[model samples]
Target: MYDLTGFQRDLLYVIAGMDDPHGLALKEKLDQYYESEIHHGRLYPNLDTLVEKGLVEKGTKDQRTNIYRITNRGQREIEARRGWENQYLDESATPT
Candidate 1:
């Protein structure tokens, strides 16, 4: 998880938050958050990286679309990250 780039970490969080998440759907969420476009070249390869890292699992939704889901390891990593963050942050201090 620490090895992940910020973009990849954001991608992981988005993937965990969505239900039956696919490439375009994930892109839409990120695009809205970024207030800009998220290109396929950037999106797919990072998703592939998460897949390669065993944090995310990819499956076929259709011929053209791919679905992504977080693995148990991925969920654990998120929990661990949150715990690490909590050590430094109090309820009054919102994380930016």
Candidate 2:
């Protein structure tokens, strides 16, 4: 949660938003969101970090593909983060 880097947090959100996203799919989503290319060396290692932290699980989809999903721990963290954010943000707050 608080220990995760911003990029890793973004990764978690993207993974949560998608259905069993793989490396390339995650990369594409990030690229579109960031409007720039994401390097493999950067993406996979962070994913491995999430797996090691037990916030995410990695599973094989095929000979050449791997899928990712957030664990229950990860979901709890997301909820906690939302709650923490809501503490300072009014529910009806709108963009200027």
Candidate 3:
């Protein structure tokens, strides 16, 4: 997880937060958050990286779409990341 870039980390969190999201769906969520376009050349390769790392599983939903889901290892990594974050953040901080 620490070896991943911020964009990769964001991808992991998005996959974990949503139901099995296909590539375009993932792109849409990222666009909504970034308020800008994300190129396929950039997106697909990074997703492939996550796949190679065993943190995410990629499966086909249809001929035209690929769905992504976080692995158990991915979930554990997320929990670990949250725990690490909580250590530095004040517990009483207001939401947003």
Sort by TM-score, best first: what order? Answer: 1, 2, 3
Alpha-carbon local distance difference test for all models: 0.95, 0.94, 0.92
Off by over 4 Å in 2: 91-96
After TM-score superposition, the amount by which residue 92's alpha carbon in candidate 1 deviates from its true location, in angstroms, is 7.8
Query: Quick one: RMSD of model 2?
Result: 2.6
TM-score of each: 0.92, 0.92, 0.91
lDDT of 1 at 26: 96
**Tens-digit lDDT track for model 1 on 14-92?**
9999987999999999999999999999999999999999999999988988999999999999999999889777754
Clashing pairs in 3: none
TM-score of candidate 1 to 2 decimals = 0.92
Model 1 pairs in collision = none
- Against the correct fold, how does model 3 do in TM-score? 0.91
Clashes in model 2: which pairs?
A: none
